[model samples]
Every structure is written in C-alpha cells, then in structure tokens.
Target: MKNQTTTTSVTTGQMFRFVFGQVLNRRWLLGLNVLALTVISLLEFVIPQYEQYIIDHVIPRRDLGLLTEVVLGLLGTAIALGVLNYLSTYYMGIMSQGAITNLRTELYQYTLRLDTHFFESSKTGDLMVRLTSDISNLQSLISANMLSMIGSIVTFIFVWIYIFIINWQMAVAVTLTFPLMFLIYRVFRTRIHNAFRAARASQAQMSNQMQNTLTQIDLIKSYTNEDLEENRFGAYAQTNKQDMINATQNQAIFSPLIDFVNYLGVAIILALGAYFVIRRQLTVGQLVAYLSYVAMLQGPIRAFTQILNQLQQSLVSYGRVMDILALKPAITNAPNPVNFPAIKQGVTLDHVSFTYPDSDVSENGPVLPAVTDITFTIPFGKTTALVGHSGSGKTTLTRLIDRLYDIDSGTIGFDSVPIKDIRLSSLRKNIAIVSQDVYIIDGSIQDNILYGRENATDDEVWQVAQMADIADFIHSLPDGLATQVGERGVKLSGGQKQRLSIARALLKNAQIVILDEATASLDNESEKAIQHALENLMKARTSLVIAHRLSTIHSADQIIVMDDGHLVEQGTHESLLKANGAYAKLYNAQFS
Candidate 1:
C-alpha cells in the first residue's frame, strides 16, 4: 500500500481567512471583543495625555484642585480599561473556544467518512496528532495570542499618530528603524516556518512510533525484544527533541534581533527628543509624552516578533489540519441514490475485477490485481463456502460484496440492484460480517454486543448470546453482561472474544451473513458449539463462509474453490470430492 502522506499547501492569507472564518461563526461575540479592544486602546492613548497635562500644567501651576481632578480622571480611565479588558478576554474566550470546538468536530466527522484507502495509507498515530495536538495549537493561537496581537496593532496606530502630532521630526527619526525591524522579520520568516514544520513532522513520527510499539507490546515481549523496541522508540524521541530545539532556537534568535532593532528606534527617539527639549524647539512635557508614545509604538513592534513566531507554528498546524479537511472521500453516494431493498435474490458478481489503488509494484512491473475477472452468485437463504490458500482473494471477495471497495471492472449487484446505486448506509446496514480478526472495543460486554444493534432490548441481547452459545460464559462472570473488557478486549481470551463477535453479529440480524474464518480462534469444544450456533445464524439468510479448514464446509449448499485470485472449482462437497480437483486436493491435504 502507498505510504505517501496527504498534504495540502495553503497561502498565509488563506490560512488566516479560514481560521478567522471559524471565529466569525460567533459574530456577536467577535464584534463585542473588537469593540472592547478598541476602547482599551483609546484609554491607553488617553493615559499618556493625562501624564503630559500633569507634568506641563498641574505641576507648574501648583493647582491642588486641578491635580485632584486629573488624578480622578486617570483613576476612572484605569477602571474602564480594566472592565473593557475583562470583557474582551471573556468574549474572545467564548469565540475562540466555540470556533475550535466546531472545527475539531467537523474534522473528526469528515475523517470518519473517508474511504478505507485513506486509512490504509495513513498512520493512526499521525492522524490522532493532527486531530488533537494540531487543533490545540490553533486554539492557543485564536484564544490568547491572536487577540493580543490585534490589540497591539490598534495601540500602535493610535500612539504613532499622536507622536507625529507632538513632534514630527522625532516620529520620522524613530520610524526609520521600523522598516529595518520588518526587514529582519521578513528575512527570518521562512526559515522559522521551515523549522517549525520539521518539528511538527518529527512529533508526528514520534507519536506514530509510540503507538506502534504500545499496541504490539505483547508481540515484543513474546520474542523478548523489549530492548530493541525501546531503542527504536528512543531514536524517534531523540529526533523529536532535536527538531523542537531547532524550532525554539530559530524563534529565540528571531525575537532578540527584532528587540535589538526596537531598542535602536528607542535610542533615536531619546536622542532627538532630548536635543529638541534642550534647544527649546520642544517642551520637556511634550518630549516626555512623545517618549511615552514611542514606547507604546514599540509595544506592537515587539509583539509582532512574538506573533510571527506563533504564526509560523500555527501555520504548520493549520496546514496539517487543512490537509485532512481538504480530502474528499473517494467512496461517496451517487446523486439521488436508490434505497437498498430487503435481500431476495442475494448478491451477484458479474466478471468483477479489483486492484488495490495503492498496491505495491515489483521492481520489474506492477503487481497483479487482487481479484481478477471473478464472477459468482450468492443465492438467497443458502450457505456458500469458499476455500482458498492465503492471498487467494477470498476475504477480498467478501469485502467487494459489502462495497468496502468499488470493483474496478464489471459490477456487484445486491438483489439485482447495482451496489453503487444503493445508498452506502442502507447497503451496509443489511450485511453483517464476522471475520477471523475480531475487534472488541474497550467497554462492558453489553456495550460491545449492543454495538451490533444499539436499540436491542436486554432480553434480545441475552437471546442472541444464547444462540451464539456464550450465555453460559457470561453467566459465570461476576459482572455478567456488564463485565469490563479492557482495551481491545484484552481481559478476554481469544475464544471468548470470538464468541462475543458471534453474539454481536447474531444480534445485528442482518439479511446477509459473512463468516470469514469466524471459528478459527475457538478451541475444539468451542468450535463444535459455535458450529451449531452458526447453523442457526445462517438458516434462512444469504450466507458466505471462508474457511481454511475444509472439514467445516462439507455440508455447505455449494463449495467454491479459489486459487491465485481465480475461481478454479465449484460444486457440492461430494461432487467436488468425486471430481478430485482443487477442492479435493485441498481437502485431502488438510485431512492427511
């Protein structure tokens, strides 16, 4: 299968628009936040004016009453600033949280709908990182840093205009350094972004390694390869550590350089203001106020450097997230899809062919299709058995029947209805599969069984469990149906897990049943019991069974033998044995 990572590149402008678009979902909250920030910026500008007045007028005139009044005005402005800051923060919290929550949910829902091909080519750990860590990065950007960056811009604009009004020459002198700081940021921007991207990739690799190792810990222990696994994991961790340090180092260097340029701007303002004040071209009070304004102007410039760092990292995360969101599921319902009817004629395949989209190529040429030009019929209310060697396309045939993948050529029909024409949800709901590799969720026994039929009553659940011959096992457990099954049903034995799978499939009560080595995990006694249960489950249903054990299918209504992706033999078990063809060969080998 292809291992290429799916990625979508978006321009900086596009990224901002998308993130802000989510924030805009709560329009009123965003509007209120902007208003609060604007008032706070104006209040910040007003405070410097008060400082100028006190120094130039109140102190010189020695008017106690005027001083008291100006002080009261400053006090009131401070209170207003506090209130506005609180409201702004609160409003931003609501907007950012709501936006991130909605975006995260949308991403998850989209992922669930994606085709199996996408998942086969993707790592579970990397996908988890994108959904969780990457989303969290965006939340931080939107909630705290982004609004603060906006406020800084507003404050800078107000302060810049005021300083120019008080003294144009000083404003012009300090402004020269502004371009140099921007130049520094522009020069370092791509480098910082590249570093952050590398870090993010490294983190994904590390997460993938951790997930892989943890999931297969039992295998590692079986072979006593814990040290080997640990060493492998350590390598991933080391790479991640280095990449993060590299990103942090780039940010560290970038910020200080910007700060150095900002200090240069401050020095120019100081020298020019002092010269003007001494020469009587500017009042000391006006010079002080200009200095204060210059300080305010520097705030945004400094903030820009920090924001740039955050912007680079957030952009990396944004790209990762958008890459997933941009993907359109390969398998989607046709326009005005036909609702699947109850099965009567059963499934039919007419010269069907399928090649996995990501199938690996040999050095000489491309590999053969998984199933090639196959044709067969699964008649209603009958059990048809498929016997094949490993990789003989038996399981692939079952998946094709269920429309897990669309055939590359010809067609698969469900009760004479073209499978693709049927609504995907409706088609899948009517088919139930019990495969060799049973998957049991980490939940109570009842929860896992109910997954097959969520609305099934307690009595109905027990009935199916009894039919699957697992009711006695449940009764023996202290918690019975409520018994906790650890992650992947780790608490249960293989036989128990398989039995639960049978119970779940029995509960689904689907019109078509597929048993793909369903009894492989069961012991001799359990297998005998489950075979009886299977007889009941398959009765009056269109059933398809794939088994390596030839003995199990002796009573099947029809037996089909497959070899190297081709149907080689078909007949009743006795006829196939009498013919002594592929089915007889497999039967004799197993029996011998």
Candidate 2:
C-alpha cells in the first residue's frame, strides 16, 4: 500500500502538473483542449478591433457600403466565437469524463490493495465518497475550473493591453479600481473556501448515515425501530442542508458585491473617457472601444471568482483522498518472497501470540488475548480438530495459520520458512477453508465451484460436487448445475449452502484444509454427508478442523482443546476422554 500525504494547499504550478500527469496518456484529448481554447481566445481578442473599425469608419462616413461591410464583419466574428466556444466546451467535457474514469480506476485498485487495518478504521460510505465525489471534484478542477481560470487571465491581460493602446488615460482610470477589488476578493475567497470545506464534510457525514441505514435495514425492521432510524437520518440530512445553504448564501452575496464594484469601475471609465472626447483629447470611436474592453474584462474577472471557489473545493476533496492513500498495508508479502511448494512437512505455530490492534482485555472490548503463546504441530496425512466453546480463540488461531494476520510474538512457518517470507499467493494456493458461515454467490452451482479456480474444467467441477455429495442435490433441481443461487444463496437451505461451500473447498484440492465449524449449521443428513466428504478430502492433506458438535470429530487423529486463548490438551478422541481434561469434559457434557 502507498501512503499519501494530505494536500492541504496545492500550488497552481503543482495542480497543473498533477492535471497534466493524469492526462498525459490521453494525448488526443489534450491536443483537442489546447487547440479549442486557443481558437476561442483568438476570436475573443478580435472583438475590440472589429468594434473600433465599425465605430470610426462606418458611422462617421454614414456610408451604407462600409456599414454593410462592418455588419458582415461583426456577424462573422460572432459566428466564429460561437463555434470556437462550443468546441472548447465540448472537448473539455470529453477530457473531464475520461480523466474521471482514469482516476476512479486507480483509486479503486489502490483501495482494494490496502491492508485490513485501514478498513477497520474507515467506514464504507466515507471511502465511497472519496472514490466518487472527491474524484469527480478533481475532474471538475481539471476541466471547467482550469479552463475558466486560464481564459479569464488571458482575457483580462489582452483586453487591458488593447484598452491601453486605444486610450491610456481611460485604461489607467479603470485599472485604479483593481487593487480594491483584489482586497475584497481575498476576503470573499477565504470565506468561500471555509464554507465549501464544511459542506463537503457534512455531505460525507450524511452519506455515512444513509449507508448505515440501508445495510441494517433488516435489523431495523425486525426491531420495529423505523421511527428511530428516521430521526437519525433526518438529523444527518438537516446538517448537510444547513451547510449547503450557508455555502450558497456566501456565493450569492460574494458575486453581487464583485459585480457592484465592477459597475462602479465602468462608471468611472465612462466619466473620464467622455471628458477626453469633449476636450478633443480622444475620439468618440476610442471611447467606444475602451468601454467595449471594460465590458470584456468584467466577464473574466467574474469567471476568476468562480474558478477560485472551485479550486478551493477541489483542494479539500484531494486532501480527503490523500488521507486514505497514505495508509500503508500492515500485512504484505516480502520483497523477495519464496514459494512453499507442497507443504511437505506441516504447518507449525512456534510460541505464536497475537492481539487485535484496537482491542483491550474486557468483556465489551474485542475478544481478549485472541491467541496466546501457543505451540502446536500437525503431521501430514491426518486430521487434527480444534474444539472449544464460543470466543475461545478457535477462529482467530485459524486466521493466523492462513496469515490473515501476523502473530505479534511468535513465528508461524510453513515447511519451516517463516509464513511472512513465503509468497502469499503460494501460501494461500495450498490452503482451503470452509468457514462456519457459508457465502453463496448469485450464480449457478457450476459457477460457484469453478470460482475456486478459474479455467477449471467441467469434469473437475462434477468430481468435486460428487465428492462433497452436492451433485445429487443439483441434479434434482430444475436447472441442475445451471440453477441460480439467487441473492446470497437465499434459495438454498443452510445445509445446502454448507454443502456447496464444502464442495468449493474440495475443488481447490489444496494440501492444507481448514473446516471452521463447517458442519455446525447443518442437519443430520447433510452433516453426515459433509463429514464423509471431509474424510475423503483429508486422505493425504494435513487438516485443521473446528467442530462444535463432538460427533463430527470422533475420528480425528488428535483433538486439541482450548480455553480462552490457551491450549489445554491434545490427543486422540479415546485418549483425551480418558485423560479427563478440558476435551474430555466437553465430550462428556455434550455426547455422554
């Protein structure tokens, strides 16, 4: 995982660089955007010249011939400006959409590769907002915001220079008002930035609440808590609405104030230019050109204000995204990882100890001492069952063996090489787990079995299905292997779902198998069938079985009993029953 730093304030040059980096691969779009913007600016610059020509030449002469020519010129300029403006906006739309796709793909890929710890701390909805809204805002900055900023600055400079050339006295008079406008804008900019930031935060908080409500809709219904959930959602929505109203109010007030100042500047220019004309210091045509320049300049200044607000919002969104990108995966493979081919020996836990990252020892806290300094070994070609009461760390220990988490204080090795050093792909490839809770996809039985390994032959699918005793059940269905499982396998009974999960694990043909209470939720018939399948699957593979019912583990080569986080006993069923330890006590209580 790559850790990203918070982008509190990005420089204009840096933002340009980032936008360019995102678009570098899309050269066609880049060329189109540049070409369009240039043509549009060129058309706009020609406007003042056209106005001057019409005012001085055609009007003074009262010549219809020259008037017709001036009208044609103005019409041509309007048509060209409209065409160029359309092209610029059209190309920007295409680029913004493409850039959004690229950014979204990268963000999703990076998020998936992040370590489990990051997920433990972040909410799904918050991460989702970062993916969708934040990235979209960035695209907005690249497309509309950048273009507006560029166009405004270009127009402001070009128009000012033309005004100076036409009449310096009027240009200077209009220029004098800019310092005050800049000061006023700086204050407005600060308020808008803060307001937009608050709006984004409020929106993210509301999204989080909505997601929570939807995910737990069933729970709320069962508990008859609709009114309570509605109140909670209402509170969140209200907060978001308030923030948006504040932001909109600030923008409304800011724009009108800027417009008022601009009008005042135009009035000043008119007064001064008329004086120059009356005194014969400047021509009427020159005054008309100066006023035209002032009108053009106002468009860019207002545009600048809008772009500044957008830039601030983008910065805030970018900072949120960077917060997630900065998190490094706590569990990852070594740089030069080695492969463990066959698990020739066995899996070993040498004084392994682990504690959850955000847990403490308490009833309400996370399970205490998830795993203590426990040492164990299971030889190849045997079944070793892990039996314990609930919350006795059975599942946690299994997770450690699979390297879902690293033990804090000991070594977990596969064939004697530290598990962390072994290539993660190789380690997981050789192990298969059928957890107590089965998950079925919304697809055919064939699809589910083949999910264990893509490109699996149909023959291989039937073989595992038969081995797990699910082939007969599928054959009885109307669609057989092609039958849909429906949402989360809701169409199948708990026992059927368990059998399918078992079939999935068997299809993997891994050397090390883990059955975490695999048959705990099944009926007697399904349990017997699944247990028989387990026996066949365990023939040559080293197996770790967690069974809630004693009947499921009677044939184990060794049964390890755990209490809280410590191992209390390990022996064959008969031997442990005679030893009268934790395992024996459990067996007698449950099966005697």
Candidate 3:
C-alpha cells in the first residue's frame, strides 16, 4: 500500500496571512476591540489638548480663573482615561483569548487525527512546544499585547498632527530623526529573528533531553550513570543558555537604540523651539507645548519598537506551527467509505502478505517481507491462537487486522468485506486489542475503568470490574474505586494493571478482541486467574490471541504456527502436535 503525507514548508508572511483569515471568524469581537482602542486614543488626544491649553492660554495671561478650569479638565480626563483603558484592555483580552483558544483546540484535535506514521517521524518535545509554548506566544500577540501596540501607533500619529499645527517648522525638524529609528530596526531585524528561531530549537532539544531522563530515571540509577546523565543535561542547558543570551542581547540592543532615537528627537525639538522663540516666531507657551508633545511621542515610539520585537517572535512561532497544520495524514477515510453495522461473519485473510515500511531504502538494497503469503480464516465467535517466537510476524498480523498499519499486498476482510472500504471509526469502535504492556492513566480506579465508556453507569462499571477480576482488589482499598493509580498505574502490580486494562475492554464491549500475550508476563497464579477470566469473557466474541506460552493455546479452536515470515503450519492444537512439523517442534521444545 502506498500513502503520501506532504508537509509543505511555509514562510512567515504566508503564515501571517493564514492566521488573519482564521481570526476573521471572530470579526465582531475584533471590531469591538478596535472601537474601544479608538475611544482610548481619542481620550488620550483630548488630555494632551488640555495640557496645551493650560500652557498657551492660562500661563501667558496670568489668569487664575483658567487655572481652576484646567485642573478640573485634567481630573476629568484622568477618570475617563481610566475607564476607557479598562474597556480597551478588557475587550482586546477577550478577543485575543478567544482566538488562541480556537487555534489551540483545533490543533489538538488535528494531532489526534494524524496517523501513526506522523508520530513515528516526529518528536514529542517539538510537538509539545507547538501545542504549549508556540500557542502561548501567539496568544500574547492576538490579545492585550496587540491592543497596546495599536494604541501606541495611534498616539504617535495624533501627537504628530498636533505638533505640526503648533509649529510646522519645529515639527519637521524634530521628526527628521524618526527615519533613524527605521534604520536601526533594519540593521537588527534579521539578527533578532535568527536568534529567536535558534532559541526555540535549543529549547526543544532541552525539553527532549529532560523528558528522556525523567522517563528513564530508573534505568539511569540502576546503571549508576547519574554523573553521565547530569553531564548530558548540563550540555543541553548550556546550548539553551547560549541561545537565550543571543536573543536577549538582541532585545537589549533594541531597547537602547529605541531610547537613543527618541531622546535625539526631543533634543532636536528643544534646540529648534528655542531658536524660534527668540526669533518671535514661537511663544513661550507654544514652546512648552512642543516640548510636552515630544515627551509624549517618546513612550509610543519606544512601545512600538518593543511591539515590533514581539511581532518578529510571533512570526517565527507561527511559521513552525503552520508547518504542522499543513501536513496530510498518511491514513484517512476513503471517499464514500462503507459503514458496516456489524461484523456478522468472520475475518478472512486470503493470500495476505506484508512488509514493514522502510523510509531509508536505497537502490539495489535487500528488501524483506515481514509476513509472506499468510492465509487463514478466523471463524466468527471463535478463538484463533497465533503461537510463535519473537519477530515471527504474529503481532504484525493482528496489527493489520486492527488497521493500525496497512498490509503491502493483501485482502484483509471482516465478514468477507474488504477492510479498506470500511469506515475507520466504525471498524475501530467495534474492535479492541489488549497488548502485553497496558497503558494505565494516572487516576482513580473508577476513572480508568470509566474512560472506556464515558457515559457508562457506575453499576455497569462495577459489573465489568468484577468480570475482569479487579473488583476484589479495588474494594479492599480504603478508597475503593476512587483510589489513585499514580503515574502509569505504578501503584498497581503488573497483573493489576493488566486486569484493569481488561476491565476497560470489558466496558467497551467490542465485538472483536485481540489479546497480544496478555498473560505471558505474569506469575503462574496471576496467569491462571486472568486466563480463566479471559476465557469467560471471550465467549460469544471473535478473539485472536498471540500467546508466548504453548499451554495457553492448547484448547484454542485453531492454532497458527509461523516461522520467520512464513506460516509453516495451521491446525487444532492436538492435530498440530501430531503433525511432527513446525508447530509440533515448537510445542515440544516449550514443554520439554
């Protein structure tokens, strides 16, 4: 089977364009955000006008009466500014939070829908960064952070307009230095982008290294390699440190350059205004107002520069995130797939064969089939046991049946219907597989059991717990079903975790069940107990089992014996024992 998953790399500009369209769905909220900021900006402009009135009119006339009015205007403006600021911040916050929430939720669901191969070629740490850190960085840009920047831009523009009206010549002289700010950004923009990108890469490596150590802590200690692991962690930390330093250094350079450019503007305005005042072209009150406007411009200019830095960081993050969003899953439902109500007959493998997918294959290199010409029929409501040594393609057969991986050249049919035509949801929902190693969620015993069916009644949960033979242990605990299982169910024994897994399956009540060496690793007592429970549960259901122990399959309806990649024998257990072939040899060797 051939499948293609294309991950087309996109640039930051393309990613930004995509994001703008995505957030447009919340256009009403975004519009309200703009309205609020506009009000705040107008109010900010009104306050500066009051400052100009006090300096130009009140002080020059020595008018005490205008002083009272000016003080009242300032007080009133301050109160209005507070309220407008709150409204502006609140609406933008809502819009930003809503945007990020939608993006994060969609990305999470998309990750879940991705096929097995995508994860095989990806790293958990990098994925985590996309979901957590990258999403968070984007969130800041969409919300309050963005609103603040917009307000700054409005301030810069409005203040410039008033300064021109107050003294055209001085306005031109002062703002001449504004182009210098652009030149400074041009010099360092690429450096900052590269620094942040490198920092993010280094962060992912550190996260991966940390995750590796935490997951394998026991092995590290058992091998007494604490010092080695510490050194490795130190190396990752050093790389991360250097990357952050580079990014921070660029940020540091950005702030000071912004300050120098803005202050230079102020100095130019002061010198020109003083000359104009002496030449009788500008009044003292007008000169004072000009100085005040220059000061106001300083905050917005610096703020906008900081926002530019944030924008660069946001663009880098979005570029990485879009790369994941653009990938197509290897396996997806076919157009007009057949949805089976139920499997009425049985599974049939007619001349089936498979080979593992090899991405590293070279021309003229050897290729090997994992299973070759393997053919069999599992009759409905019966157990077929696959008994073989490791790497004998036993588990591979079950995986193909479950559609975890597609076979190379084969017709795998459920009830004689080709599996490829079936709807994946319907197929997976009706089937369940219990592997040798069970993944137990860290939660209450009841929570783990109820995870199989969210809407299952507590009575239904208790019944399955009993059938799986885990009810007694759960009841003996003080917390009963509510007892915590710890991480990966570490609080429970291996046998306990296996039974808990069975309880989960029992809750799902799938029609087809595949047991992959479920009882192979347990003690004799645990094995006997779980096996008896499994036999009871397997009744009236289609069960395919891979057993490491020969005795476990003695009563299996049909026994399949495989050697290398070929099926060497197939018969009932006793008939296979009498054949004096591969199955007989394997059985005798195990017992003897």
Candidate 4:
C-alpha cells in the first residue's frame, strides 16, 4: 500500500523457489516428465551419430542390409521418444495446474487474513491482476520449456563430450565463444531488466485505472463525465503502449546479440573443420555431424534469453504478490485471549485515541487524529445514542469497539476483560452493525438474511423480516424469500435496502449492536417503521446508535454528544438540552 517501488531483481533461481517447491508436490509425475525428456535428449543425440555412420559407412560401402537395420533402429527410437513426449506434455499440464491452483488459493486465503487497512489503501483491480493475470504468467514461465531446457542441457553436455573426443581443436574453438557470449549478456541484461520493470509498472497502472473507472461507471454517467474518464483511461493505455514498445525493443535486441555470438562459434568451427578434413584428420561426415551439434546447441542458447525474459516478467508479478504477503496485520487476536461465552457486564472505552493510516500524509496535512482521548461505557441492555456533527468521530468510535482498527492509546474492555484479550472471531460474533452504507451481496433476500445467522431457520428469518418491516415486501414478490437482491441490492430502493440490513442485524441477535445512522436515508414514514423495529431489536441488548435526526433518539436511555473527537456532553436528551451544551446545540439545530 505504501508508494515505494517494489524490490524486483531476484535471480531466476530465487524467483523459481516457490514454483519449484510447488512442483515437488507432484514430484513423481514431474520426475516422469524429466525422465521422458532425458530419453528424448539421448535419442536425439543418437540420431546425429546414426546419420554420420550411415553417410560414412553404410552409403559408401553400399550395404543395403546394414542400412535397413540402421534405419529401422532410428525409427524405433523415434517412436519410443514420441510416446514419451506425449506423456511428458500431458502430465506437465497436470503438474502446472495443480501448482498454480494451490498458489492462487493460498494467495486468496492470505489476502483474507489481512486487516481492514490493507484493503483501504490497496486497489481491488490491481489485486485482481495479481491473482488472475499475474498468476497465469507463472504457469508458462515454469511449464513452457523447462523440460526442453533440461533436455538441451543433457544433450549439450553429451554432444560436447562426443565432439571433443572426435576433434578437440574444433570443440575448443567453439568453447572460446561462451565466455564472450556471457560477457555480452551481462552488458545487455540490466537494460532488459529495466525495460520489463517499466512495462510491468505501466500494466499495473493501466489495470488500476480500468478497474476504478468500471467500478464508478454510474458516477461517471450521473455526472456526465464519461469523456473525462475516457481521456484518463487513454492516457494509461498510451503509457502502457510506450512501456511495451520499450520492452519489446530490448527483448528483440537480446536474441540477435546471442545469435551473433553463436554464429561466431559456428564460423570458427567451419574454418578449422576444413583444415582438419584437408589434413586427413577428419572426414566430411564428422564435420557435418559437428555442424549438426552446433545447430542443436542453439536450442539452449536461445532458450536462456527466452527463459530469462519470461522469468523477469513473472517476477514482476511475483514482486506485487510478495508485497501483499509481506504485510502483518496490525490488528489480530492475542496469543492468549479470553474464551468467554458472553459479556457479563458491558462494553467500556477508556481514553482511546486513533488516527487512520494514510500513504500520503503530507497531502492530507496530518489528519488531526479522528478520535482522541475519548472514553465512554454502554451499560448492558441500554441504548446509548451518539449525537454529533459529521466527522466528530461517532462512526470511528463504533469501529474501534468492533476492533476493526486498533486504538493508538488506551483500552477498551468487555466485562472487565480487555477486548484485545478476546479472540477476533469471538469479538466480532458478539457484535452486529447496521452501517449507513448497506452492503447486500448478490443473492436471494432469504440468502442475504441467512448471512446474519448461518443456520437460522426459515421461520426465524420470516420473524426478523417482520420486525424490520420487510416481510410484506418479501412475501409479495413472486418468489417470496427467494427473490434476488441483485448486486448490492440494486433492485431495492434506499429505504428497502435499509430495512433489509436491519432485518439481518435482528436475525444475528448479537449482544452488542451498533446502529450508526442506520435510518439516516429513510423518509419520516419509513423512519417511523424502522424506529419501531429498532425498539424490538434493541430490547435487553446494549445498543449504540448515531442518529441523523435528533428526534429519533430522544427516548434513548443516554445521549453522548461529541465534537472534534472529544466527548462534550453525556445525559438524557432532555437533560442535555437543559444543559445548553454541544448536544443541546445539535438538537436545537435540527429541531428548533
């Protein structure tokens, strides 16, 4: 989430550690693939020797019977190797899929473990790229030619040994070029790396822009700023285009640079080979075979750069994923936490202070700490309403109680036990919230309500729906409880959505309930309907409500008024108005 550049220059071996570890999970199958590749390499190596022998012995001697036998042997090896190739490729797919599936699943589960702050600063679209596109890149990187590279390595070593035995001078001539090739690669490597890094950055930026634009499509259309959005997206696309061009340029040059080195080696082999043949030290077939070796050598030579480029691209994705994995949640359950079944007394906050984390603090000019040295207690079975102007830390206080964010200082405890000493699941299960921003998943209305209590009965669901005044709406639909809510309840009006949320909370039946402006969007009639439901839902439960309309909470057991993150007054609404303080001012501003 921080704006610092990610570290991305790890060696290919280092980049492949995770992949190799994953491959080992299907080690036997992968081992078979390796074995098959080894056979293919050995058979291919034998074919060149057979070609040389047929030219030097069988053809010159005109032994049709020997030629027939030799040709048949070659055919048999090819057939066997072909079968092996099929098995290797088929099972390699199985291996790659298995590994990538596990990796993606682990990444998703790990992302879920991260606290609220991580999602707050991170982009959903960028994370999607890491999970989907980036994860996809890793497969080709490992499976594309790993087996071929292995085969090439085996063949290269064996071929070199054979060629050296036949004529070490020609072999030596070819060997000299390797160090020079490596040196050339060293020179171009950094430029290639930098180009890939730039391209990856551009890709991430483009993905982020596209994701944000699509998510806010409604806002763009509502404000008639579609052209503005289009221009912004085009800029990202153009930047990506330039990055791709730069990357392709570097990649395009590297292969030729390597090819040039390989050509130099071949040239030296050719010139020396002629001298050997003239001196009666070598035959033409041997020279041809040596040339064949040189040609075969190109497989690995080209593979090296090809593999390196794909790896660099994959590591760029890896670096993004590692960045998320590196974060340790700021909020987590204590190693030893209370296993209390329920809260015995009440919830209490003592001198708690909190400031939201920001990547660009300077731009915000120090957020001035949303909640500072504020303390309060909500007695069990009592409704405590928070009254304050917007941005006065009312919602922030409730968030702290839920332990969504840890406080900068001081303690909040439940039943004399610090909330931090309670398991996170235990803490959350006991608290239910109906926030102003209603989040309804795409599912049937009953399916949404069942989210409140995973195993709530059909009758219980209907009962809570009645309390929230949404049962009639559900029953009137053709499908009743099965009627779809669409994405975020897009089919429902604002008041309908609010009632559905209330129904979910009532069904949850948590001991500690926080209703932060739950009815803020409802009209007077809808508000009255929800108010009656709230009374039923709040019965004998500790409730913390933040009211947009002052009149809604006049009957609340206690009213706490806040200003600029400080608790300015606390008492009954009538008493606060009599005191002529912050609460009175807020109430009079709305009702006077």
Per-model TM values vs. the true structure: 0.97, 0.90, 0.91, 0.95
Sorted by lDDT (best first), the order is 1, 4, 3, 2
Comparing 2 and 4 on TM-score, the stronger one = 4
Q: List the residue pairs that clash in candidate 3.
A: none
- Please give, for residues 219-335, the per-residue lDDT of candidate 4 as tens digits: 999999989988988998898898888878887888788888888888898899999999989888888888988777766776776666776778777777677667778888788
Off by over 4 Å in 3: 1-26, 165-168, 295-299, 351-358, 362-369
Better of 1 and 3 by TM-score: 1
**Cα lDDT listed for each candidate:** 0.86, 0.80, 0.81, 0.83
lDDT tens digits, residue span 448-556, model 1: 9999999999999999999888899999999999999999999988778887888898898889999999887677787776787788788788999998777888889
In lDDT terms, how accurate is model 3? 0.81
lDDT of 3 by residue, 327-368 (tens): 667566778888754767789998888887655565878677
- Clashes (backbone N, CA, C under 3 Å), per candidate, total 0, 3, 0, 0
| Best candidate (score: lDDT) | 1
Global fold similarity of model 3 (TM-score): 0.91
